[model samples]
Every structure is written in structure tokens, then in C-alpha cells.
Target: MAQVEMNRSVQTRPWFRQITPAQWQALLASSLGWMLDAMDVMLYSMVLVYLMSDLHMDKSMGGFLATLTLLSSALGGLIFGILADKFGRTRSLMISIIVYSVFTALCGFSQTVTQLAILRTFLGLGMGGEWVAGAALITESWPAEHRGKAMGIVQGSWAIGYALAAVVSGLLIPLFGWRGVFFFGIVPALVTFLIRKGTKEPEIWEARKNTRSDTEKEGSVIKIFDRKVVRWTILGSALSICAQFGYWGLFTWIPSYLATSVSQGGAGLSIVKQTGWIVIMQVGAWLGYVAFGLLADKIGRKATFILFFGLAAILVPFYGFTHDATRLLLLGPLVAFFGSGYFSGFGAVLAELFPTSIRATGQGFCYNFGRALAATAPFIVGTLAKSMGLGAAFSITAISFGIAAILVILFLPETKGRELT
Candidate 1:
């Protein structure tokens, strides 16, 4: 009777408190992988000015490099999504860490713009692949009722990684220069050891693998395009495209915009000051990720997504137009919060959309292919900024965000609390 009562009590507790050790390990591994991925990837953006000067490149070239990375990341996502399905999420995640980490460190040795570009492209593969495995792992590990919160926490680690990059750039750029910062990216490679020790593949995936016949394994990729799932794939990709466009366009240039002179249509802050502001802004993003998850669990996924997307559309233009130091500081957090919070919903909704057979593959293709299309954002913004200024270039993200909101309202189904198993 005591044991039964204790089990009942545990079940009644809040989701965080009720999480098993295995669930916590999965969450931790996924969060660390994503955080390190952001740190490794964003180091380039954080030191873009240095790269431009050192490599004797122009803004278009700098933007093109970012674009190249995103395109490669898209390909990586597709390949690794299939890998995660076939091998295991943990194994796929481990391999991706090594791929991005070694390449990122190699970037420090690049002597020419061409070499840097090639290295960055390789780095992107790991960057893009990490999310598919991490998201699928989190979805399978956590309970259905609390999956949104789990996704939110993992997504929120992105802010932490971005903040770390800013801090590393601020401290190291003056001391060791951009090359040293790139070298530091090799640190994430060590994280694979922890993941290998602490994490295991979800039982759901194992059971599916054990029971599957040879014939059933065929056409895994093609299944995403089957008649029943095709609509969700289309709509999900559309939504992801809009979100990625807004994100990559804005963030890829934000560090440069903040550091540029006011006469050049930026806030004209110092490097250290810009880093501080970005870190503070990410605090809001972290909050937004968490709040969005809780709200998603309560109000439903589509509603929460619509809310964040619509607000982001409003906030993007406002943030872009402001050059006043005080106003820019104030608006930065709001922009980050609204602009980024909706991402948490994607992991949950996408996982719920597909079955265990191809969950990673389906979600990976939708998100990364959309990312591929959105890869144009940085180059377009750079070209536009050369003419109109960075502020005006940012206003375009508002349109993307607006369209994303509409896409969710018109087509996507609510997936809150949907059991993946």
C-alpha cells in the first residue's frame, strides 16, 4: 500500500520532478550537443569582422560564407537524419559532434578565404545534423505530457551557446585573435565522451528495430512524401523556411550591425559592449523558450506558435528601425524572445507528426531543407545592406515571420501532448 501510494505521488508531481534518470541524461546530452553546436557555429559570426579584414573579403563574401555553411548543413541534416534512424540517435549525435568540432578547429589554420569557406561548409554538416538526433532523442525519452517543456529546455540551450560565443569572442579576439577562438571550438569534441557514458538509445527505437522485417525498412525517406504525410511535410517546411529566413538573416548580421558605426546604420557599440548586450538579450530568449513550452503544453502547439510568430513579425521591424542606444538595448531582448521562442514548438510538433520509423528523417528534411532555401537570407541581407543599410534589410524578416504565422493558422494541426510512441 505504501509503495502504491508513493508511485501515485510521484506520478502526480510536476513533470520536472517526475523525470527519470534516463530522461534527465537524454535531456542533458541533447542540450550540451546543441549548446556546443551553437558555440562552434556562432564563433564565425562573432568574429566576422576579423575574418573580413584578415581574409581581405567584403561583406558579400562574408555573407556568402555564412550562406555556404547553411547549405552544407542542410545536406548534413538529410544524411544524418537517415543515419539516426538506422543506427541510433546517440551514435548519430556523437558522430556529428566530431565532424563539426574537428572542422571548426581546422578553420583556424585556414590561410585563405577559400580555405576558410571550405572548412566552414564542413562544420555546417555537423551543426545541422545535431538537431535531428537531439530532438528525436528528447521526444522519445520524455513523457508525452511534458514533451513541450523538454523541447523548450533543449532549444533554450541555443541562447546559452550564443552567449558563450559572444563571451569567447570578446575575451579571446583581443588576446589570441579570431584563430584562437576557432581553435577553442574543438572543446565540444570532448563532450562526446560524456554522451557516450551517460546516454543510451530510447527503448522505443530499439523495440521498433527488433520487431521490424527487412521489407518494412525500405523506402524510409520516400515515406515522408507519402499521401498521408505529404501535407504536413509541405506545411512544416513552409513554416521552417520562414522561421529560418528570419533567424539566419537577422542573427548572422546582428553582431556586425551592433559593432558598426551609427553612420553605417548600426548602433555603433564597442565589441565588448555589443557582446554584453547580446548576452543580456539571450537571457530573454531563454525565458521565451521556456515560457513558450509551458504555454504550448497548456494552450496547444499551433496556438503558441501563432502567438510567437505574430509577435516576432511585429518586433523584427521595430528592432531594426531603432538605432538609439537605450532603445536598441531595450528592443533587443524583445526581438530575441519573440523571434526565437517558436522554435521549441517545431521539435514537439514535428516529432508528433511522424512515427518512430522515420521521425528523425521526416523532421530533419522539413527543417533542414527549409534551412537550405532560407540560406539565401544572409547573402540577400548583405547585398541589400550595401545599398539600403542593415536596418532596412532586417525589416524583411517581418514579412517572413508574418507568413509563418499564417501558415501555422491555415494548415498545421495541433500536436500538443501527442504521444510519439
Candidate 2:
């Protein structure tokens, strides 16, 4: 009897590890895909100045292109979310990677502003799809006990991608020009092969496929809004939109805000100094992502979001006010810590709120749709800066964070420790 009990315990040991090798492989693959997705998307922002000058496009055109990308991403998420649910996660992820990579490379070849805008729109679709499939796959496969960590790690990939884009743009833009930097974006397409070779369908999704009949499966993706789930969908979408508005509105302009001449109502930091500031701030963002996961797991998701976003609302305005480089350097991390930390909770919360049949669809709709709405951030902030000054323009982002805190408190349900289908 002792031997029998020992054997049972041994048999269960594999299930009890924080993250099994298979789970880690899934996380790595998903994270890499997401990282590349971010790299491809962010490449545009990093090189926007060069593109605008080379192509002779004005700020409105640049803002319009950014808006187009966001709108396309919403459509991509909706389409791919349904595909991920109906097909397999691995397949959807592979397709998304391929689509984005091909289009991103194509952007390097564009001769006109119209061509670049069109290419970016399509690229946005693939970019949007990768996250929905990857997030859903990771969330479903990871055990509930460690789900926060898994999503945290996955969410953290965005910072890595952003950092990579900055490094590549800084190095290659000097050597190969902005077009050459875009050409390099093609390298991420190689990641698709890794997915095809390394990943299998998650056990949960595979089991669902085997157990559920076609007729019994959930109906159209629109059914996500049926009587039982629409409220959560609306709440999740509002929170996500608010977050995106806050992030894109402020961070996208930091370099411009810093580097523009003082006569133009800017801080007048040099290019090298601006890059250093941007990179350093991301370090704080990285910590925020990891810390938010651990804190949410301990104190609950709602409390953690409120803490970070509330602090962000307070810190963002202060970050805008300081002109001293030393003070700016010191405050950058704190602003990022509060401003960027709450993002990790979205994966865990969305996963918990939706069931398997529509999980990806729900996640995609809430996130990508919100992104589409908030895509106006760049344009709005730019217009505001043009008229009211950059400092005042950025202060609006703080209000968005404040709004996110309120939404989470009033509407979002706690999702910690909830098992996924």
C-alpha cells in the first residue's frame, strides 16, 4: 500500500510543477510570436519621422496612417479570433505570423505614402491576430495556479519587442536608412517555422475538439454578446480602450516631446539622450509587468489594477512637468511602473471571463476593438500639442488612466485562480 501511494505521488509530480517543459515551450512560442508582433508594429512608430520626411507627408497623414493600422487591427482580431476558435491555435498563430511578416517586408518597398498606408493597414491585421491566438493559447494551457505568471511573461514580451525595435532602428537607420530597417522586419517571419515544428495544440483545446460535436459547438462569434456575457464584454472593452488611449497618447510622443526645440514648446533633449530616456523607461515597464502579476496573484486583480493605474494618473502629469534631466531620469521608471503595469491583468481576466468556445473571440474583440477606438490617440494628442503645447497634450493621457481605474473598480470582476476551459 505504501508503494502504491508512492507511485501515485510520483505520477502526479509532473502536473504540480509551476510550469512544465511543454507549458514553457508553449509560452516561449507564444511570447516570441507576440514579441515579433510588437516589433513589427512598433517599427512604424520608431521610423515615423524618417518616413514623413522622405515621403513628404504631414502630421495629419501620419496620424491617419496610425489610425488606419489600429482600425485594421480591430478587423484582424475579430476575424482571427473566430478562426482560432474554429481551427487550432497553432495554425492561427502560424498564419498570423506569415501574414504580418510578408506585409512588413512589403512596407520596405513602398514608393508612395498611399502604398505605405495600405501596406500598414494589412500588416495591422496580422499583427492584431497574433496576440489573440497567442494569448488565448497560453492562458488555456497554463494551470490556474500559475496563470498570472504565464500571462505576465507573455505580456512582458511587448517590452522586449519594443526594445528590439529601438535598437534595430537606432543602429540600422544610421547604416541602411529607414527602408533598410523595415526590410529587416522580414526576419521575424522565420518564427513561423518554429511554431509549425515545435508546437502542438494545447491539451485543453484538443480535448474540447474531440468532445464537442459541430452542431453542439457555440454558434457565431457574435454570440459572445448574448444575454449571459455582453456586460463583461463591454466592461472589458472599455478598460482595454482606456488603457490603450493612455499608453499610445503619451508614450508615442515622448521622443518628440523631448527632442523638439524649446521654441516649439518642447524639452529639446538630443536624439541620443531621448533614446536613452525611452529605453530606460521600458525597464521600469518590464518590472511593472512582472510585479503586477505577482501582486495580482496575491491581492487580487482588481486591487492591483487600481493601485497601478491610480498611481499612473498621479505620476504622468508630474512626468510631463519636469525639465531637469536628472529628475526626468529618476521619474521615468516610476511613471512607467504605474503607467504600464496593469496591462498583464487583461490576459488573465479575459481568459477567466469567457469560455473556450468563444474565448479567443472575446479576448480579441475587447482588446482589438478598444485599440481601434483609441487609435485616435496619436491624432488627438498631436493636434492638441500643435495648439495647446506638448505638456498639456500629454496631461490628457493621465485622465485616461484615471478613467481605467474607475472602470475596473466598478465593472471588472476578479478573475484570480479561476480555471479556464
TM-scores of the candidates are 0.97, 0.94
**Most TM-score-accurate candidate:** 1
Candidate 1, position 4, lDDT: 100
* Candidate 2 residue runs with Cα over 4 Å from true position: 1-17, 217-219
lDDT over C-alpha atoms for residue 333 of model 2: 85
List runs of model 1 lying over 4 Å from the truth: 1-8
Residue 413 displacement in candidate 2 (angstroms): 1.6
Residue-level lDDT for 404 in candidate 1: 96
Best by lDDT: 1
Per-residue lDDT of candidate 1, residues 1-421 (tens digit): 9999998998888767999899999999999999999999999999998899989988898999999999999989988999999999999999999999999999999999999989999999999899999998999989888999999999999999999999999999999999999999999999999999989899899898899998886227899998988887888789889999999999999999898899999999998899999998888888888889999999999899999999999988988888987888899899999898898988899999998998999889999999999999999999899998898899888999999999988988888778885
> Where is the poorest 10-residue window by lDDT in model 2?
10-19
Cα lDDT, all candidates? 0.92, 0.84
TM-score of candidate 1 on Cα atoms, chains taken together:
0.97
Tens digit of per-residue lDDT, candidate 2, span 197-259: 888888888888889986865425777898899997899899989998998887777766776
